[model samples]
Target: MAGGGRGGTGWSSLPADLLLAIFALLSSDADRVRFRAVCAAWATAAAAWCPRPWLVGSRTDRSGRGGGTVSSFWLFRPAGAGAALLRPFAATVPEGLDYLSSSRGYLALADPSVSPKAVVLVNPVTGRRVRLPPIGFFKRWLDVTTVVLSADPGGAAEWAAVAVGFPTTSLAYYSSAAGAWARLDFAAPGYAGVEHYSGRFYVAFGSRICALEADGDAPAVIPLERVDDDGADGSDDEPKLPGGSGRRVVETHLVECDGQLLLVSVHDDVVYSSDDDMGGLAVDEGGSKGGGDARAVEVHRVEWLWDGLVRLVRETDLGRNALFLGRNRAFALSAAEFPACRVNCVYLVDRQGHPDGVVRVLDLENPWACREETICPDDATGGSASSAGWARRGWFFPNY
Candidate 1:
């Protein structure tokens, strides 16, 4: 009866408002495309809707000689039910380009195999690529950790692509206005993460956070201060280790959500497992066969005061947004836009030794409500060996 009208009984007879409401409920781009094909009215309604974020999967082809060829990147629409299929773009992502980070619907990639390797910013949707000036050092020696973009390179009037890693003077940046790459004097011996928020760059080193201006001067490091617990009883204490000591903060991620800078601290406890008769073998909890370390994650939001100091606002909640952290990129998206996504949650990827390509979803509201999903399913690539081989994995948000 929705489509019943004086003109006819076809879907075209449906009211424009009703068509738009139906299109807005569709979570998949492919489904929306099909809906748009239904009629011109439906197409107009679908075109006006905004797109949701995507989880990107990338695997390397190690079968080839002298390193391996980088496989095509896959996009998955994560829904409350599960991950749904979205069209794969960059099927032949340029050879040697290893995905490092993603920001504002663009991917920052680099080739670690070659010296003076090329670093590039690419938008898979638009197939637009911008190459940064080559670094004169080897990837191994430099130990470049993460690269972040000030804005989407494809459309920003003036943008900056910054790379941070080990060794002194390890901060390198490319500015569109300058049209070249320049090294910053800021030295972070143990750099952890970098983020661009509210027209300024914030870098995380160990437990400290610093704000970097555009002039390339030395930024002041601000140490994190503890705040009173927001528990129902107004207790300032948190769960401690067996020995009564507080959990060790291993890593920190800086992110901007809703116009505020936040810091997510990763905590862990080293639990050693010893096996009998296997020569007193020791292993980390939840670790793979050879080795692994188990960690308990605690994410916190930082509140910047008007007096120029910052404090740990809270650790138990993320409000209406969810965070994605990995490969030096940390982003927050509103849960309202993606009904399937959980609010106050963190979606993380493991980019280290394990190549399982598992994506873990951690709920901030309830730490125990963690879920793991694999990005590369066994049957995804038609039995290819590279099907489960991921050179890098990240979160890619499409611009509609």
Candidate 2:
């Protein structure tokens, strides 16, 4: 909010109450985060607001991981209305660690050299970090898909973290009270993604929804008789996913929105199978097949149908809410509340976990129809990557 008072400089330094009032009017998370970045006074004032976390995308310049390999990560707002009104959150990250997904405001980083997998949760905002116990002698080939937290480590001493990915039979979790990473092996078919909601972690598998209840070893898929438009519980009326141009379902995420549960499924023609598989990323030097890295995103509202039964109804209008969906703990933000986000849309981190991949925001048209929104960073042109290292990691909600 620039204004020409006192030689065009007073607007940046508004009183706390006035800034809080202005913060209330923003509908995008990015704008609110930028609001705090205005100056020292604003950041202090924002502690009173504790605004929602804005979406952050990273560009890891995978073109060459040559020498000393220190990567800098910048967390900015994810809004379709793309003028960075504030300073983006930035940090000079240490070398040898790759960014996994983010939770609360901490970046879940993986140290590959460690036997098995050890994730270090670092909050770039306050520089507070929690080193998770490395579980199992798991190899790097068995990649961990996404991670979610029950509470922020800075805000609470006890936190629970859940991660799911490759090999398909196991998920990893951390209980700060237990003080170690433990694996919860399961017998379910390929789990797509998991979301921590209502004190229970919900896991989505093939055509099924399951919830992890209270330190349980694994989640059991909830059987359901689909609820159709007629309000009848029947599987016959389950809506077809919004089909795209030969796009395949690469990732599925469960998130909480508008006080309800939402299932977000991402489809793409070009999937990044190997981030370490950088050789293939080079093949598509044409830039995500002319910026078509992610082709379609399908969102469904979860309808709990009493007694272990659930229905997934397709949601067409998200109203003021926009969602960030990927391997990370899925989350939704309101444009009416934050103003920096696009209303009724899905923000996608690149599939195949490419730090330097593309970020696509798909506008929700209807259950059966959706077109991509132009989601480019502020420094880029036409919502497309201007150069290399433009891949988006995921969304991180910042409190500090």
Best by TM-score: 1
TM-score of each: 0.70, 0.69
Candidate 2 — what's its lDDT? 0.59
Tens digits of per-residue lDDT for model 1 on 148-189?
Answer: 888887677888877776543556767788877665655544
Candidate 1 stretches with Cα past 4 Å from truth are 1-50, 61-92, 111-114, 137-143, 166-169, 189-191, 216-247, 269-293, 351-353, 369-388
lDDT of 1 at 237: 26
Candidate 1 has an lDDT of: 0.58
| Candidate 2 per-residue C-alpha lDDT over 1-400 given as tens digits, one digit per residue, 9 for 90 to 100 | 6676776667666778987787768765456667778787887776676454544434444563322222332333546645323234335355666667788777877664555667788876556788887766444323565778888887786778887666457666677877766666554444367877887777765445666654454433443445556685454322223321233455667889888988776545533433332211111222332254435566678888766767777666788987876556778888776666666776665544343354565667442233444343343333433334533356667655
RMSD of each candidate relative to the true structure? 8.0, 9.3
